[model samples]
Target: MSQPTSRPTTATRVYLARLKGTAVFDPLGDQVGRVHDVVVVMRLKGAPRAVGLVVEVTGKRRVFVPLTRVTSIDAGAVITTGRLNIRRFEQRPTETLVVGELLDRQVTFRDDSGTATVKDVAMEQQRNRDWHVTKLFVRRAARGGLMGRRGEGLVVDIEDVTGLAVNPAHQGATALLATLEDLKPADLADVLHDLPDTRRLEVAAGLPDDRLADVLEELGEDDRVSIVSGLDVERAADVLEAMEPDDAADLVSELPDAKAAELLERMEPEDAKDVRRLLAYEHLTAGGLMTTEPVILPPEATIATALAHARRQDVTPALAAMLFIVRPPLETPTGRLLGVIHLQRALREPPHELIGAILDKDVEHLLPDDDIGKVTRLLATYNLTALPVVDEDRRLLGAVSVDDVLDNLLPDDWRGADEEITDQAMTRTAHG
Candidate 1:
């Protein structure tokens, strides 16, 4: 089936249009507190644009800032120079949940079966998309009431749920917990990566290819390509387009030349061209590792203007940090590479200043000829999510993200580790 054309963008404005919620963050880069509220200045006409977030710094106080200021988003914390005066932020009725706040508290899921004790909660975000969740990651089963015993293993999916119970003192919020099987393709990819391959593909077939593409980037390279190769060309193309250009390139490069060509033919022309370019390089070089797509803008563009451009492009949350400020002749321009800035840094600063002012001095740069090992080492040491790859002319060709590196390095390893243990158990059971 042909995929729909709606490209999901990581605009806080879009998110605000749907459901508004607290943005949980371990703001210090150490997983801790959740964002209790986000305050945005909507356009007087309609369609609100997120101006800033009301972040509750863990164990400290609440603060707010424009969404444009977000820098680097990671599993641990959101890095930013945007500091808020504790007294200035508009306080909400709700208190932000901290690490110890919900300990031993009751948590509930949309899946009925009732409340369970919170073991620990995990936070996750879509790269380049700033939405966050405070998931009750693990639980001790509820017993004595509507929910049965503690050992039954909490059921994951139910069409709907009627009731929930949690301590008002702790104030943990309930979210619909989708089963590993029931999760959307992207979420399933994360769940599957944590499981075995037999289980991964078995579950993957239930999801649409587009969603599968989102998760594929998260899987080990070997497993990711194996699953894509198993798919028909059309489905493969849909998944590939759904991925970052760097990721799409890595996956496409793995296919037989003819098969890869056929899949590329079905993709959007620009996306197709990007994959082909990366394919031309040895899979380990800076050229091979970089993505052709970067959220680029003219160097003179104001932060407000950049925000508008980002909304139009549907740039994901992760890519927002690497927003490339290029001096345009659009095709290519002269000048050494300007420093890079985080999204948070961009937003919190005065809207009028040129982005060039805040660029990082320690920017990681790579020549197209640089080896893949050099690429990964830079990522490891600098703890960077992305690196810009430029030609000898210093013309930006693309960027390489950490996800792309892991996908290239690991190669289906995540699944096999889980698979082997599962297989051994199955064999023992069969023999017995």
Candidate 2:
């Protein structure tokens, strides 16, 4: 992590209905729970400000996850920081539940137009990191319910609609930020990069930490540097912590030593510790390129748990292709590196079997100083998607995946080159 300027990014506008029951993932992308509702604090003047989400985790217990702790929110999943307050959620007098209380309520157009039932509400984040209710989706009552089409639905700005509470009001509309809800990080980064700096930073300020980190990674280095410099040091650190350790380490290396040191200290100990270790290694070395984050289990774990961990979508396919087995501590620098259970074999074994029983002990591990060439040859020879890196004592440091190797192998400007190739192909497609 390094002190940054600003995180230039696209604003994420999430509709309330789509978020309900969506999987809530942790910093590592493992599903922690499902979103049950969004909590907001109603205001006197502007749209209600969002506070956080009510997520239902283990034991059917609902807990509060604040917007500041949220890393990304999309239809597929809402990712948050690993830290959470597990205490049961209790609604206060000032708090509003968007999913529980607002949907289907009748609202009036502030201008005294007509009324429509609230179908959905959109919350948008701003440059200051605060979330505000920005839009509402409403439908006019169906004139022909059984025989004909239902009422028309339109996206409307929040100011045009009245009533956070259930009240009889008309729903006339105005278009807001409905189009930005579905953009991929790369596509969204392009859009943000083209915007004026002020607007770009404003949107970036509002994005979830992990999402902003992704968009920043897609931008050119100059733009990336400018944006990071714009963010406050604390927030800059948060974004970096949300990023993959290797990416974070690379970005941190680009900063002034003093700033980098300060920002790393500001990061969570677990996250900062990994990046610090990465910083000690050569950028192209196996230890530097490999992510410290990967599925690790102790010897006592079973195939059922291992398989479930492997099936998670958050971990990249390469990382998921093998599970590292260690001694006592499950975290990286994990106890003596025993072996890896390849996903292909794990799939065929009975779920009840112990993972230690099937562990493939023959795989040779790489030392931290191992060159990229060695990593490539080992992976190629074994036909492995990833290979473990270890200390002299055979303690697991991390695992290097195929993509990490290729990313470093490619030219530094490969992303720009890729775009050029794509544009040329599109031009040919048009003429052909």
Candidate 3:
């Protein structure tokens, strides 16, 4: 409730700070109400800032004070000289706007080509020690069909939106994107389906690829294809390259053949081949989730050498949790399938020991033709970071990382300015 020392830039600037219980006073110096909320009218270019103050005027009689006439503020109340009687102000809107009333409601705005919905607001504490709303988090619009039934979609950020208003009377209940903190992925997916296409895409582009992939997977094949189609090929390739090969393959395979080929053409050769191979199988099969980047190593390699190989590879740190040991000879080999070794355990052993000697001989793996459900269960049951998919002959084909599995399960809100979890970390100023 502390005020900033600087003069505010505009009327809307006054609404940037939270004002849940500020006092309201009239001309005779009599306190008329307690402010319960500050409604912000977000404006873009060429628009005026309008703010509505929700105030509790008397016992059970609530009024909205237009912020245009507010003159001053001190420790006790806000000074205003608006002409409306308390009852008349209350009757003007017919729709009550309170902080609590607006809590989970989806506020929409017109953007580049469609509408965006308020996903979250980004605020931070300044060096001078006042809090202010800096950005309005919006879910980018979704495309394809009405009621989330079909088509490709993409999510990205739409910057500098400045207006916020209530939906017209005929729009029914406002549907909002959930930021309730702990909602399950399933529930979050339902919320994603309710958002307009533009809002969904904006939110999607902001999140990390892993989380976005999880949400897309949860949306089912058609929705996933639609969402990916909205992204440029480069963006799509970046996402595909980041995802586990199998999952990436599954998404691309679901796209129209032309689009899928175009996306593949944009990816790195090794990645393109892996995805193309995965596309040859039914989506529900294990091949759909198999990656081609298993941690292959030679039988002659010592623990020291294997460790060095993992560091040199582009595989994520998570994938290094378990390192795959293959024959030393790349073309043809004569060693048995040495058990997989936990990268941590391998690191602790004496440097001179060959990797095969330290491996846990009992290896559990799946054939490429196996069901995806089996692969998921193995990942969950053993709490693995990367699972190796093999051929019927026990030769390694590729690997699936835990991150890939998650992408298949959530609505991609990839981190955006609005989804920013970290506000500036503020330290209290010492008294001078």
Best by TM-score: 2
Which prediction has the highest lDDT against the true structure?
2
Any runs in candidate 3 off by more than 4 Å, and if so which? Answer: 1-194, 205-223, 300-320, 328-337, 351-353, 372-387, 400-432
Per-residue lDDT of candidate 1, residues 1-432 (tens digit): 121112212322122211223344333444333455444221112221233455666566765543434554333344443323233354222223323243355556565546655433222234544333323323446457544756443322212221222223312111111233235445555666665665555545434333466678666666787787776666577668767777788777767888888888887676677777778888667777777766666677787766654553235545565677665643322244565666777778888887778767567778777876777778778877788888777777777777666545543344445443334433322332
Ranking under lDDT, best-scoring first?
2, 3, 1
The TM-score that candidate 2 achieves is 0.63
Model 3: lDDT to the true structure: 0.55
C-alpha lDDT score of every prediction, in listed order = 0.53, 0.76, 0.55
lDDT of 2: 0.76
lDDT of 3 by residue, 160-193 (tens): 4423444434222212221411344455555666
Q: Model 3 misses residue 251 by how many Å?
A: 0.7
RMSD to true structure for each model, in Å = 17.7, 12.3, 24.4
